[model samples]
Target: MDQFTNFTRKVSANLTPFAEKVGTNFSQLRQIATEKMSNSAIITELPREYVETENRFEPVKHIHADLVRLARKYALDEGNVDFNKLQNQFIEITSSIGEKITNLASQNPQQQNTQNQTQNAYKPLNVTIQHQLASACISNSEIVGASLYKFGSTYEKIGDFRVKMNHDILENCINLLQGEFTSNIELAQKSRKDVQGARLALDALKSSLKGASSSKQAATAIEIEKAEEVFIIAVQDSMKHMKFVLGSPIIIESLRNFAAAQLEYFKESQSLLETLVTELEEIKLTQDALYYSEVDHH
Candidate 1:
């Protein structure tokens, strides 16, 4: 009986604070509801500081959300050529061709040795046009086929550079923007919620103050003063956090990194394509001469 009495006492001690908290919350809710429904209940006006902070926070919130969305869109891997996949496909095609060549040359030991040597010396091409033209070159269409192979090789390098550019943008720009949103913007949003809750509680207490009896009015006034201080502090914290996010240099740095990656990619691509275009013009001259010579013979 003594042990049971002690346990009961311990439980009651634990529940006492919880019960008081529940009662306080219920009173605040009742006051808020009464203020909303009863025309006789006085509605407290929010502080000007809080109202101004909230107004500034609203636009910042939308801007942060928009930036995060744009970051995700920019980081999307779709439409970008995958260099690894292209290389793998190139390997598969070359391996198949090598096997067939080896099989056909198997009847003659000398020819088989030559085929093996050719296969060992072959460089794998990633582009489809390169593979097709290389095969045509092997079949004796030398000029056009060799020129196309050179063009395709450079094109493959451009594809690799494009993939690298995409990765750099993701790592340097998109990731940093997302990190800022999570660390600063999200924290500011949470603080804003705290401010809103503190405002509601402060307003509820103020509305209930008018109904307090003379004997309890002094205590109610003290509670309202404490609530006001809490509301003010909450608003200050929220505003500070919002300002940090709004003024962050990370966003500007991220934009710069994104632009830099794109610029590098385009510049390199343009340089490579320009060189290939010049080479193609030379190849066209050779091709025209070969065509005219063949036409004269026919």
Candidate 2:
């Protein structure tokens, strides 16, 4: 009998906290329903400091979201061409060139040198319509002559610069902005939710105070004071979190990095293209003079 009594005491001890929690939850639910039905429950006004902090946070949140979106779009901005598809096509075309050369060399073993030259000569023209024309131009210029090859090489450098610029934007700007949103903004939001829950709990306890019997009124009032303290602390914590995010310089720094990367890319591309244009003009004049000389001779 003593053992059974001890066992029963242990079970009750284990269940006591759970029972209390369930009871508190039920009371809160009942209070919520009563207030919803009658609208007689007094709504507690938040402190002015908390209200001001919340107002300040609103614009920061809006701007942060907008910055994140703009950064992502800038990182991925490929005008009309599908960059991934073009890269894949370039890979496929280059890989096939090696395979075709190997097959031709094997099929005409005695005449491998002649066949290799002929096959390589025909390869560039074959890929012009199906692949990136700039890449095809590079292959063709390599076989035909040196002047066109230099122009194709400059064009290739521009393509490479664009790819590097996008990568830098994604790595340094977009990713940094996203990290701020996740680490700072989301944490502040969670703190705000905690403040709301603490406020609700304090409000629920205050509502219960009016119905307390004379014997329980003193203790109930004390509980209400403790709940009020908890709510105040929650508000302060939330305010601190929100302020940290608002005051952070990461957003501005990321934007600056993004702009700097773009500026460098454009500057380099413009320099290369301008030089190429001058060279092409000189080549065009020389070709024109040669054509006139041949016409006069005929």
lDDT of 2 by residue, 29-77 (tens): 6666766887687566788988898999888888878887876665555
TM-score, every prediction:
0.68, 0.66
Q: Which stretches of candidate 2 lie over 4 Å from their true place?
A: 1-40, 79-133, 136-151, 287-298
Question: Model 1's lDDT to the true fold?
Answer: 0.68
- Highest TM-score against the true fold, candidate: 1
* Strongest candidate by lDDT: 2
**Model 1 regions lying over 4 Å from their true place:** 1-53, 79-144, 292-298
lDDT against the true structure, per candidate, is 0.68, 0.71
For residue 113, model 2's alpha carbon misses the true position, in angstroms, by 16
Residue 268 in candidate 1 has what lDDT? 88
